[model samples]
Target chain A: MSQLSGNTKWSVAKLKERSPVRWHERIGETSIFIISLASILLIMLMAIFILKEGLMVFINPSIRAEVNFRELFLKTVWQPISEVPKYSLLPLIAGTLKTSFVALLIALPLGMLAALFISECAPKWLSEFVKPTIELLAAIPSVVIGFFCLMKVASWLAHAYEIKWLHDALTPHRLNTLVGGIGISIAVVPITFTLCEEAFHGVPESYRAASIALGATKWQTALGVVIPTAMPGVIAAILLSFGRAWGETMIALMATGNAPLLDLNILHSVRTLAATVGAEMPEVVVGSSHYHVLFLIGTILLSISFTVNGLSQLAISSLRKKLTGG
Target chain B: MNANRRRFRLPKGSEASGLALTLLSAIATLIVLSMLAIILVDLGSGGYRKLSWEFLTKPPEQGMTGGGIFPAIFGTMFLVIIMTLMVMPVGVLTAIYLNEYAPKHALITRLIRTSISNLAGVPSIVYGMFGLSFFILFLGRRIDSLIGAELLFGQPCLLWAAATLSILTLPVAVTATEEALAAIPEELRLASYALGATKWQTIWRVVFPKAMGGILTGAILTVSRGAAEVAPLLFTGVAYYLPQLPLSPTSQFMHLGYHIYVMATQSPDVEATMPLQYATALVLLALTFLLNLIAILIRVRLRIIAGEV
Candidate 1:
């Protein structure tokens, strides 16, 4: 009886040690998991807070009475400081879209062409230098870019336009949306070029050889076969660039005249939601209706960026699936 | 006959176009170089004479008419240093955890990755709002150099500006560090484990040291970015003028970025110091460029060493 009891007691003690060891291991894993979860939760809370404060503008009847949503959305004027603060988002929205679209127009072709040159046509030595040089553009801060735009690009554009009689007569503001758009285009090009170049580089050499074997010209192979293979990546690059342009603040603030007036002409001065938030958010009375309105604008900006990024990711995954299946 | 003609023409066409392509790439490079040149020229022509030792060492006098960027410079450095100290460890550790320890397909891991990416896209101004509300108001902490009973160090009172800039640069640091950690060969980890080493010991002893160069490269980039940021500092509390140098961490400090912004936009006497503004901008740009150059150099050295090893 004594010998049997001794064996059973030893087994029980071993089981007890193993259980605590497993418990401690599980706790360590849980804590690490929780830390990551908390960080993400904090960011989401930031988004929710902005949205909550911004939505207050629509919910409160008093603020709604101050500015009609219909007129704010549709009207040409954006005189937010007027006796009746017209909060027409048209001018700001139009300015942002026009500048961003023009930027996209210039950046897309130039960036893709640049990518093609670097990836396909340039010698290895040339590519070695070109890749880093292009990447350096991405590293330059936006404020520095803004300073250049303000001091250099704007004046250059003004001087160039001054020589054209018709251009001067047609546009009063030399520092207009067009100038801002062009400056922003310069900023986006490097980014697009980097991503697109990477995508093009990822294309297999076998595909290029296959096309060449079929008697396709180099340009023809690149444009027809390689580009199609990298289409999803190219689209993702363009969308990401667009999102960047849409959110850019300092360049628009410095180059655009900060005029809140609504107009379609690329020559007209304009304001963006980002610029507005930057210029005015500091002075805004905390928790006031105007303050909340600014937060709402942030929410709008976030939503737009989220949509663009989401679409890009979706397109990339779908393309991957298709490519892999075939 | 057709085959001979095509074969003869193809090499010639490619060579000519290749030359043209090289030229275009050169021009693309020139565009960036020219922009930098124009900025340097404009600043030099406008403010080179005024960039004296006194201009960099003295405090602002007579509403900045006497021309001093000492306070601003101190504030920028203090903010960047503090931010780097706070962000580097957290960012590097989190990166290690993500790359080495975390299970793939875990919800928490995906959330962290997505948030960091999304945060990168959020505008600087929005970060200002978040900082102002959470750091200043919600915490009920005045933008001063003290926390309860402790004297926190650095100019612009280091803590506030540090927190703001840390948030701004965290995503970059985390992303870069993760990339570095990911680049480590799995065999290294397995070798250590095969020798009966614990997982943490293996990562600490082997993986991190190998990835240090890339980690430092990322840290340098983060510091450069933090130094250039203007919008967030505006809200977080960068004083435009300081009568005394921020010799101690507890001293009130002014920052260069805010001073430039003030000189350019809000100065009461813009005409008198227009050149001063340009010079200040020049100094800031040069500083950023130099920092970036250092980062690139480190990256190149690492690649070479990595190759040789």
Candidate 2:
């Protein structure tokens, strides 16, 4: 008993005199705060660098005075590599809008209805089986999708739409806005489906029960009440995916044949802003005017995506606030 | 009473209209599902022929027309592993700070969350540009000058490539880990505090173990997404045809997705290398799917166990 008491006393003295852990609490806290703070700083730095590089086009009086900002930015000519360099962003913006618009047109209805089916109509087992399978679509890389389209779908589309009944002598080619849009639709569908389903699921059970109780059929309740309640979120999903499709690089790079044509024709090839940067940035000389122009394209891509993403995020949060009556 | 009765009663022909609309929605669902089915079936048949032992083990022969994708595979694996290591710690720590330490509803918290979400939405090409301009050009050039080396870090290499990818995937890792940390019950932390543990001690002892599955899922997701990405690699470190595996972090490496892109678009004979392209796509797809499946299995198992807990 005396020996045990002596041992305990000695250990207590040692414990009180010397701390066991290597790091003091304040030291650990400061390091963690710094680590977390560094991530935010890094993100800020990257954004600023891209913006600064892009702003060079506007900041350089030589280029701005030589080139009309509006005409260079809004016109159709984009030949930077030639002897007479005219960098117009119109065609790329037009291509982005055309492809993303087409993709949303195909995806929105299909994804909305799929979401409706999954949330309201399908049985427990089928809904369970389908959601994961559809989400697996999101796992498919854009590059693989582009490759598949380039080799198989493009040729198939060219032949499939090789009919004169479409009223144009210019036929659909293997690489066109239509094929790129279709490839992008495959990627967009999963995103729209996932978000739309969440919106639909978020519609309260009481709303559904009350609608059905008031003698509305299941379909009527879903189409009228549930969808209307979830409409904001659903629209946000579409805009979010619009941003996705617009910003997608690999699919457009590979499948669209990268023809920078300033036309509204879906059957003709179009090169997107993202595709232009991906294809042209590598060969460009460092610190050259061409490189700065590519950065301008990146800036354009960033702003469009940022605007779309911000709008969707705003829409979603407001919807959440309204729905929660906060 | 009569109005109420009428409102409760089904109007004539309503059921038929409802059935028709339901049918339309179901058909839309079928169309989307069918596309998935078709793509998988098409890729399966097309890529299956090129999945041979020699194909996986040997380097490209005949101008990348007949050789296996061993070098590309090896490079991709190295890139993803290094990227995962680089990203996982930073991401998890950020997530931990957000979920555990940060004061809720604070301006700093909101700012951090918004920036993190915004980071995820930035396009791959933009990230590629950032890596090239800032990382390789600015940072790498400065390092080269300081070290008296000739264009060592100022050019495309595995280091800048992995670093760029780590940034690209930061959002995925943080989001997943945040979700994981949020999944831990508040009572667990309270209980640790009741038992005389410090906040740091509680985090290390109580929260981390419970959140391991979620953090792992996020890590796997980041790795899969990073591994398959080719655009950012186009300028960062990917070689046109360096079949000899990347010897070091500063060395250029061939990538599977880039290999497929090269084969698809720039090959002298596109038709001949088309099979190899599909095969490469298949391997990339398989790798992505396999990682996702592992993450899913881990998540489902954790959920079941968590349910009991």
**Highest lDDT scorer:** 2
lDDT of 2 at B209: 91
Worst 10 residues of 2 chain A by lDDT: A165-174
lDDT per residue as tens, model 1, A77-191 = 7666657776777888888888898778877777887788788777888777777666666665666666666666777877767667857666747567877887788778887
lDDT per residue as tens, model 2, A1-326: 99999999998789657756646876877677677775678778887889888888788776565456786666888787898877888888888889888888998889988999899999988987788788678888889999888887888887767577762666666699988999989989998999999999999999999998887889889888998998889988988888888889999999887888888889899999999999998898876666777898888888877788889889888779868979
The local lDDT score (0 to 100) that residue B254 gets in candidate 1 is 75
The TM-score of candidate 1 is 0.86
Candidate 1 accuracy as lDDT: 0.74
Candidate 1 Cα deviation (angstroms), residue B95: 1.0
Error of 1 at B105 (Å): 2.8
State in Å the error of residue B172, model 2.
Answer: 0.5
Clashing pairs in 2: none
Q: Residues B56-162, candidate 1: write the lDDT tens digits.
A: 78776777777578778877897788889987876776787788887788886777887777777777776776666666655434433346534233222446667
Q: What is the iRMS for every candidate structure?
A: 3.3, 1.6
iRMSD computed for candidate 2: 1.6
Tens-digit lDDT track of model 2 for B1-309? 999887678778988988888898899999999987888888889999989999999999998889799999999999999999999988988889999999999988887888787888888889999999889989999999999999889899999999999999998998999999999999999999888687898998899998988898889989999987888999998997884679799999989899888889999998898888889889998999898889887887888888842
Point out where model 2 deviates above 4 Å.
Answer: A1-23, B1-12
Docking class of 2: medium
